[model samples]
Every structure is written in structure tokens, then in C-alpha cells.
Target: MKNRNLIIIMISLLTIISCENSYAEIRWEKNLATAIKKAKSKNLPIMIDIYTDWCSWCKELDKNTYSNEEVIETAKKMVSVKLNPENSEEGEEIARKYGVQGYPTILFINADGFVLENVGGYVEGEKFVPYMKNAIDKLGKINVILSSKEPSLEKLDLYMESGNETEATKIFNDLLGKKSIPDEAMPKYLLGFGLIRAQQSDYDGANSYFDRIIKEYPKSEEVYMAHYYKAVGMILSGDTDKPKKYLENLIKNSNIPNNIKTQYQTLLSYINED
Candidate 1:
């Protein structure tokens, strides 16, 4: 058994080394503007590394994370750019625009200039690979949404469906700034905002939005979902009793879909089991 274990470990090490040797390098662009232009022309997404000369973690990222075979392979699908915030005025301006306060900030931007994801701080190769994959997945979905002639609010819904909260938040905030939003759209808008806040782990903020949807738009189609999410937020906030009662009430009195009612029942069973 000992000999077999040793052999297995050796084989794994050899495979890792082979993968490392196969990828040459990620061809990194020096200028952000040029990288963006190439990405737009080629219909590719952009990956920007915001680094500084004096940042040790930045060098470590180049040495460790960037050298990972998976990261190199994934980076090939996008236009990669490296910008030093202290190197030029343009770099400084762009860094400020993106709110890049930390060193070695990685930004994945779609071809149309919307940031798909922002990864802050130093991350290991194993963890960093997933962030790149998520950004790429979001980029594809956002591009499709952008090309469609969907109405602006519907586009926001599409973004939420695609799990592109960064873009959705931008549109949501912009719409909120408007003097008046049609009553027909307000329930959906509030629900979307609540979902975003929930994703951010701000249960209080999320519940506030859900409350608005339930109270202000009681007759709207989104009210039932608002009730569901509010219960979820309460559950996540470490209080299961209130949500349990709320779901019980919903299950008894609400005319929600059978499938949704089943989901609520399952949640209640799981909560009871816990």
C-alpha cells in the first residue's frame, strides 16, 4: 500500500509539471486602450491586471497564479492587459475610475466596457481559476443580452437571470435615480434589488427591499416572490422561527404555484430536521 501511494503521488506531480511546461505564457498587453480595442475587434472579453511596481503581492501573482496552467489556458479566451497605476497618467485615471484601491486587482470586462467581475486581493491559483471562468461565463451571457433589442428593464432582468449582478447593480442604480418609475415595473425592480442585496449578504438591506415589494406592490405578481425571499433572508440571518411561521402562513393561505409550494414545504422540512 505504501509503495502504491508513493507511485500515485509521483504520477500526480509529473502530470502537474507537464501541464506547467505546456503553457508558454499569457500574452499580456501593456496599454488598456489598445487591449480594449483588440477585445472589441475580436469580439473577446478583456482581463485587466491592476498592478504596481512596489507591490510584492503583484509579483507573487505573476509568479504563482499567472503561471498556473488553468489560468493561462482560460486567459487565452480574452485580451489580457497589465496596467501599472503609477506608470502613467492614463493608468492612474483608469485605476481611479474602476475604484481600484488595492494592489493586484483583477478586472474582467466585457467587450462593451461593462465590468463583469472584480477580483480584489491576492488569490491562489486554485481559487483564482474559478473567478476567471465565472467572468468568462458572465461575459458571454451579457454580450447576448446586449445584442438583443430587449427593453431596458427587461435587459436588467436578463442580467439578473445570467447572474451578472455587477451590471445589474449599475442599471438598477441608474433607474432608481430617475424621477418616476412606472408602477408596473417597480415590483420587479425592487425584487431584483432585494436579490442583489441578498447576494451581498446584507440581510437587513435585502429584507428592506423585499418589504417594499410586498407592501407597496401587494397586488403585483412579484409579491409572492418577495415573501419567499424575505423568509430566506430571515433564515440566513440566523432566525428560522419567524421564517418558519411565515412559510407556514404562505403555504396555508397563499395560492402560489404547486411547485413553489412544494419547495416551501421542503424548506420547512429541512429546517425542522435541522
Candidate 2:
């Protein structure tokens, strides 16, 4: 009886290991030509996962982000392809064309082979799902925006203010692509503000924009506000450590205004009360 039980356990362990290995080993294409050909044949959009072998975050994205259920389901609608930037000339060319300066860039290309968007870095399931959905939805609006004779910020702002978040996001992304908008203090600040207001209920959206603000405009006054808003959004989203970390950063930053410091302290106290 003991020998039989041990054999059963070993079989179970082997099965589990096989499944795990299968999931870990993804079908990576060497070049974009194959992906494009497949996309044309299948009449599907292409999703290219650009990475290098040495990138730890790239591995995490493969293991966690792309393995996510929603990501996998959404990817099924498209021609999924993985390319190593260092290994393939075609992949390198695509990365250069799309302005991918970093590893783990995910490019969503239209059926016609035009690069729609280039999203970089590792993102978990919750954040990744919304980004994919937004990217898919934005393609149509991008056509409209690009075809328009006068593509103005007003139109973009209207879309943003009118609750057409997907369209607004696309317009902003398009603007960024064309280099029409400056990445100066003012533009980043405005974009961050708009994202915060537009996605008040969307903790992930708010967090994303606030994070950009912190990264891009660390010296700007908006950083303090962004930190506060990020903390609030994180707390609401059940990210326990983020709120505390943001608060602590704000508290330590001597450049923060007295009123903002007071507010941060008050919020911190409130959070710690229970």
C-alpha cells in the first residue's frame, strides 16, 4: 500500500512538472516576417513581445504578465509573436522604428502592418488587461484622428472630457507618437491631471498616470500631488504598502509645501488609525 501511494505521488509530481514546463516554454519567432505572414493569413492583428534574454523583468513578463488569463484570452484574437531584440535584425529594426529603447516592449500592430502602439515594461494581470482592452479599442479612434484634416488638442480634450476614455487615450498616444506634444513639465502635468480626473474611479488608470508624473517630472510641483493621489488610489485598490511608501516619501521631501505636508500627515494618521 505504501509503495503504491508513493508511485501515485511521483506520477502526480511528474504531471505537474510537465505542465509547468510546457507553460514556461513559449513559441518565440526569430523574425517579424513570419509573424506578419501569419497575421495576413489569419486576418488578425499582431502582438509582438520584444525582449532580451538578460532582462529579468522580461522573464517576469513572460512568466506572469503574458501567462495571465485575460492577456492570454485577448492575445488569442491576435497573431501572438515573441522576438528577442539582440538576436534578430528584423526585431531590431522594428524596435528602432517603434522607438523601443528598453526591454519587454509590447507592440500592437494593425492588420495592415502599421504599428499602433508600443507599450513597454512588465505589468501584472490587473493592469495588463485594461491596457490590452484600451489598445484594441483605440485602433478605430486612431484612424479617425489621423484622417481628420485638423487634429487638434481640443478634439482630444473633448474626447477626454466627454467620457470617451479609450478615444482620448488614443488621441494622446497618437499625439505622443507624432512628437506633436512636448514632454516638458507643463504637458506631463496636464496629462497627469487629465488622467487623474478622467479615471477617478479607475485606480489603475490613476496610478499609471501618477507614476508617469513621478518618473518624468520628479522636480515639478505635481510630483507631491501625484504622490498623494497615488497613495489614495493605491489604498483604494487594496495596495497596502504603496500608500505608506508614498506618504513616507512625501514626508521626507523637504521641497513639499507645508499645506501638502500637513494633508499627507493627516491622511497618514487616518490610514494608521485602524
The candidate that achieves the highest lDDT relative to the unseen native structure: 1
Task: Show where candidate 1 strays beyond 4 Å.
Answer: 1-23, 157-274
Please give the lDDT score at residue 238 for candidate 1.
Answer: 91
Per-residue error (Å), model 1, residue 233: 26
Local distance difference test scores for all models: 0.81, 0.71
Per-candidate TM-scores read: 0.53, 0.44
**Worst ten-residue run, lDDT, model 1?**
149-158
Please write out the lDDT profile of model 2 over residues 119-146, one tens digit for every residue.
Answer: 7888876578776666576656655665
Runs of candidate 2 with Cα error greater than 4 angstroms are 1-30, 140-274
Q: Output the lDDT of residue 132, model 1.
A: 87
Residue 31's lDDT within candidate 2 is 60
Model 1 agreement with the true structure over 1-274: per-residue lDDT tens digits:
9999999999999999988776567889878788989998998888888889999999999999998888888899889988887977757866766667799899888765577788898998868988888888887877777886533665777666544667777776766677345769888878877877787678899889899988888888888789888888888889989989989988986567777788788878877887
